[model samples]
Target: MSPSTYRQYEGVKARRRWITVGLVLLAAAFAIRSAQFGNPLIHVDENFYLLVGDRMLHGALPYVDIWDRKPIGLFVLFAGIRLLGGDGIVQYQVVATLFAAATAFVVARIAAPMAGRIAATVAGIVYLLLLGLVGGSGGQAPVFYNLFVAGAALATLTALTRPERNAWDVRRQGAIAMGLIGLALQVKYTAVFEGLFMGLALMWASWRTSRSPARLAVDMALWIGLALAPTLAAMAWYAAIGHLDAFLYANFLSIGDRSGAEAKELTRRLAKAWKALHIPLFAVMLAALLEPWKRWERGPATFGFALAWLGAAIAGYAVFGTYFDHYALPLFAPLAVTCAPLFTYRPYRFGLVAASLMVLSGAIANAVIVRKSQLKRGHQAEMTAMVNAIRPRLKGCLYVWNGDPLLYHLTGSCLPTRHPFAGHLNLLREHGAVGVDQETEVRRILAGRPSVIVDHEPTPRDFNFAVVAIVKAELKRAYRPVKIVPLKGSRLVVYERVEPK
Candidate 1:
């Protein structure tokens, strides 16, 4: 081929590559656009995260003023999003969409070498589409943290493929990967299992090139320290502010103290998650059992790494014993990459069929989930009505005892207590799990006499009845039922304090 002709061809190829990436990102945004804004109660966790983040902007500390088991870094991300523009919900959703898209791009990049570009791009799109099926349509913590995990995997994979020219270059890449994992840890601590796997994978790669045990040991220690640095820094900041104990208990100890669901309930949840996620899970198992490396010469190391990452993610999800479908979010990225080769393999056509089923099933499931979520939580009109009803009656702080915590943000009312998340204080599983005693905190919030108290009728089956009893007594003594805003599935009962005549 002529030199100029070859150069022109390469230029066109590069532009097409970029265009494909742009298209993937656009596809991600379109897939999740339905749930982007004006839906405050997309998920209880996100609602509380947004509330905590907005509070932070006004100088409220996380563990000190708003409590949750989630790492502080997640709140910081939301706060940074709020700083960018209007209501925190829309901004965070946009940011999460970007994160989901970026992670998909990385998924494509990782799979391209083994699977053809077309197959790899399909893998990326599949990742985005499946996110909605798993409650990741909005700013779920996994939606944000998965990008960091994918980036770390990409870094590790790159280091694995590169010929050992400079040992330091490989070490540098490992450091960057560990740093990314540390950041992911801040978003959600479950990233630790994945981080540990990636760390060991990097060390294994280092050992291959450098045969010195001492050097490997030093490298391992440095990577572990890097992975812990972000969490330590957060703890140090809390310590400096004299809230270190609060930080430690909420972030670490609280999880252990929490009670687990009954065996039947847990099994039911696990089975449900499996039903929703069976496609990807089955694909992962097929890839492992088939041993794709044996059939494709170029796939041994990459497939091994991807499979191990998927395993680590599954371990993380199962470790807590609570198999909420959203916990499977971290698995999607690695699942997509691991199954990329299936799209192009001609022998069994398993990958192609799986991909088609996943996309089609995921789309229908996502639509139903979004519609139900909107119905159950109410749309913008319903939210506005609830807000308006409570705002005027709120003479002081607002206490969201058993309803959407987003009211705390939308009503522009002060929080009645650090435990703004209703489930943390109301659920049977969290009776003594949160850093503060549930009964004492509820009493304190009641003593403060919040101007408006929001409660939901037909309380959850697992509610802490003792705490509910105290709250009911207080409402009877000092509050009067004012408005009942009917949601699709339930009614939000707003109570205003009785004024002394």
Candidate 2:
């Protein structure tokens, strides 16, 4: 080989090495930043997931024992964490840190071919920097799903760029890509949309290379079938256990059943957030679209498929109808690659550094502002006090009605009700479905007569106010309020059943 060509190859390898080191550093930074205050379970959702995971570790299946719309793969990760001796919130944060790093590595890999080393590193850095920005903390579904989704995308890109004239090799790669997506599906159903986008891109790329529509169509169908294995296997397990119906409801219908005017509120919140974040990301994506020819003129197929990935990610986020800030995390992967021009374009290379600083600064500001203090001093402090003050008063199971799940774990008591968190049940009530009806839950509460009932009211309709209204009335009749501990954004009132006069 010519010395100049060899030099270029060496240069690529050196850039990759630097990118690898940068990703490792950024990941470490993420871990430190995440633990900056403490474990990153900013939302009660993490607590709930942790609770469910612990329950599953004790042999309880999701939806049957404790109900949530989260896919099985989510609980599986949590259960695995439990087995690994890191079942607490701190352990969850550690796992999330690793996932953030692995995903950034995949982002860099996808970007390296099309956008070169600078863009590649930028992609990785973007992911690492933006993870904490959404405030999902360490254990959000996206934390894990992003890694699986990106790995799947990488596999798809690999399949698309194969130079092997061997058909079996192409099919094998395609199946692997789809299989990774299948595993992603198990993490969260949102991966399906991104999977669909990759599937189409793979088909298009395959048709271009093989020029045999019928053959490719057959193989693609098999690849799709391969993708369904994880989901299908899950269904079979639930079916075997005679809880398939519950499985369907939790994974599919529960989310689908959530309807009504609340969706508008979610959209509005999303819109406000989008305005703040749009400029830097949109500018990069716009560059990708405008310079489509340049993006795919050489290198691997990451650029083209990344466009699909972004579209699919956006479509998934929009159609899901919930606009939680963390929901926006999936957008960063495609945005990073699309932003390649930020580093490659001489006029805009400086903009890359500037935009990153803005993102980092903005994230820090948000974390500081939202955290209300250092992580340790914030909600964790309140919860610690609540556990210490309240655990002594508890004799039996703990009941958190429309309140944080950490209370259950912190208080070290069993769950008193199947319906724990109000996040989903509130939506079900808006459907006018008896599925989350107040009467049933009220009966459970009265029957169990939980030793410590924590009633939290920070926001209207944050709980099933209507049903919780009934539950509260019953608790008032049978129990007396023990303590009201005010915490950030929420206050907890502990109720113990009144002893007979």
Candidate 3:
């Protein structure tokens, strides 16, 4: 082709890429805003983040001064957003949208070289839709982690495809891969699965032996070093804060040994996710799988990289006892990548139809599930009102027990007690110091000097202490009962400690 023709072709390709990115950005922004507008009240895990982030934003040092189990990487990301987000939900939405968009772009970049632009576009769309459906409308670290995973996959694929690339260039790709892995680790430790998968692909590529084993060994070493850099930084930060134990024990160990019910619940969720993707992607995958393995051989090493990544991911997830749908997220990218080959086969259209239908059906089912799980707005409003009314009259600093996270976020106070007052009465006996435990626990709290116990719906169990009973009898001896406010068809009680002369 003539010089002018070449320039024209390059310009067109550049414009197409820009357009692709723009569409991804627009779609992600819409999804994030929808999630934000749907529910702003804190949910289970989000509440924990809200509590931790609130403290961190307010000058409380994590690890050094406060107790939380999140890795330093997540804390840094949340802190940066919270600092920039202030009190606005829009800020969170924006961060989430940006991450989702980045994830889509990563998907496209990874797919383009393996499949054509058409396949890449489809993959990007698949990622955006899947994340929105699974991640909900709100932006969270999982969404960010998904983006990083995709980026790592792209880098891994590139490194395998171009073994002849210069040592420095290969090292740079490895560094990018490792950096992405580090970011994923910070987002959630479960992301270790993603790193493991990518690493396996890298190792397999190095072993392909078109080159001398020594050169491959040298290349592998450089790449491994780049990847370890981020994790080491996180560990160093943990050591600096004297939180290495908490990182290792509390976060990692606790997740490992979750209760039976938690494990079962996670398994059930994963089963549902498997069905969601399987029914739709199966047809396409079969065609791709049946195609002459020789056809795949024609591509640069991305095919092998995809195989190793998907395999390692499946194996890693299986090895871990704690299972969640989010844990299965890393697998989605490689599966989707592998699915890209189906679009090229003549019969693959059948799979696309099936996959599209499954996606739609799964999305509808997921929406219903999300809706059922949401707390009624009236319930939230009622709880907030009662807590606000009783907070002022209560003595000492008010702590919320078994209360929603908003209470902490809105009130900016510590937990009512580690042992939630909820329905569990035994918590009262277990942790509530009568003359002795109370004297110690209460004195320690008072040392920092806050009074007042605000609790919601005490649980029923051994030593199950009713909030009403605690206020009326055991605690009333020292705390004055102010009022009981009914919330969302439930009850919230407020009390103040009587000052002793």
Candidate 4:
């Protein structure tokens, strides 16, 4: 070929690659745009995370000043975003969008060698679309951590496939992969399952390449240590501050103390998630089972690796025993890669059909959520009104008993107690789970005489009635309802402390 013609062809290929990346990012932004900047009530968990992060910036330590079980790394992410600019709601949304896009890009990269580029790109887009259906439309933990896990997978895949590389080179790649897994662990401990799988896979690859058993054992130990480094660093910091026990309990031990949901409730959640997510689930199963074995470019080994990754993700989701829809976010990337070949299988195009169904269903589900937020005035106007009302009256602090925890950050008011997340103190399932007495925490918060208190009426059925009764009694005694904000099928009543005669 002529030199100019070769350069021109390369240029076109580069342009097409950029275009494909742009498309994936655009899909992620579009899918998650509904819950960006002003929609603080999209998910209560993120709201609290943002609040804890904001407070952390002002010298409040998590597990010490603001209590929750989320790893400190997640809060550090939010705090870092808050450090960049205002309020941090928009910043975190933007960061989450980028993370989602990057994760999808990694999915495409992992699948492109096995499936054609077109098929791989479709897999990435399908992943972004499926996220909204699985409650990952906003800044869920998986949204951030999935990117790390995907990177680890990519690194491990590259090392496994390149057996001609020197032993040191392979070890280096293994270390990088394990380090990424360690970072993921800090975002959510569930990444451990995937990390474990990838670590073993790396060891197997080394052994297959004729490494000695003693060397393999040493390599495994090094990789495991690398994977735990981030968590150990975090523990060391807490130990220096004399709060290691608090960190230990919140990060490791607290989950076991919580009560489990009733079997019926757990089944109901699992059924609901299954109903919403069956199309993608079926697509994953069909692709894994029906793909022509001879067509895979990397042969059965690559396909098996992807399938094992998916199994690890499923184990991560199931280990917690709670089947919340968002808990399934870890599965999307591996599912996408595992199902990519279906997009290019001769005349079937089953992947395209599944993608279409997923996009349509996901769009409809997100539309309903956005419309409900709009109708209830919970996204911007309602929250703004509540914040304005409470901000002016805040002489001491703001207590969010049953409403959005974002109120603490928005109102810029001090917290009444360390347990700001309502469920930790109010949910029957968390009666003794939060490493503190629920009733005592409620009393302590009320005794602080917060300037404004936010509570939701028609309490949720699963709330601890004892804690609810304590808050209600105190509200009646020393606080008067001042502002009522309507939400979806409920009201957020803001109360001001009553002055003595």
lDDT of 4 by residue, 1-501 (tens): 999999999999977985867686566666556454556676788888898888888898999988888899999999998887878887787788888888888888888777767777777887787777656777999999999999999889887886466667668889999999999999999999999999988998778765688878878888999999999999999999999999999999989988888999999889967865677667767776777433866746666788899999989888899898889889889988887777766656655776566667766777676676455536777888898889889898898898788888888777777888888888999988898899998888888788788888889889999988998888888889999987668888999999645
lDDT of 1 at 334: 93
Between 1 and 3, whose lDDT is larger? 1
Model 2, residue 60: C-alpha shift (Å):
1.1
Model 2 ranges with Cα > 4 A deviation: 1-19, 22-32, 162-166, 289-301, 352-356, 373-377, 424-436
> Per-residue lDDT tens digits of candidate 3, residues 360-424?
66556545544544432223455456567656654434655445554555555555443222222
- Per-prediction TM-score to the true structure, in the order listed: 0.93, 0.88, 0.76, 0.93
Give residue 389's error in model 2 in angstroms.
Answer: 2.7
- What are the RMSD figures for all models against the true structure? 2.4, 3.4, 5.7, 2.6
Query: Each candidate: what lDDT?
Result: 0.84, 0.70, 0.58, 0.83
For this target, which candidate reaches the highest lDDT against the unseen true structure? 1
Greater-lDDT candidate between 2 and 3: 2
Candidate 2 weakest ten by summed lDDT: 425-434
| Whole-structure CA lDDT of model 3 | 0.58
Q: How far is candidate 4 from the true structure (C-alpha RMSD, Å)?
A: 2.6
| Alpha-carbon shift of residue 363 in model 3 (angstroms) | 4.5
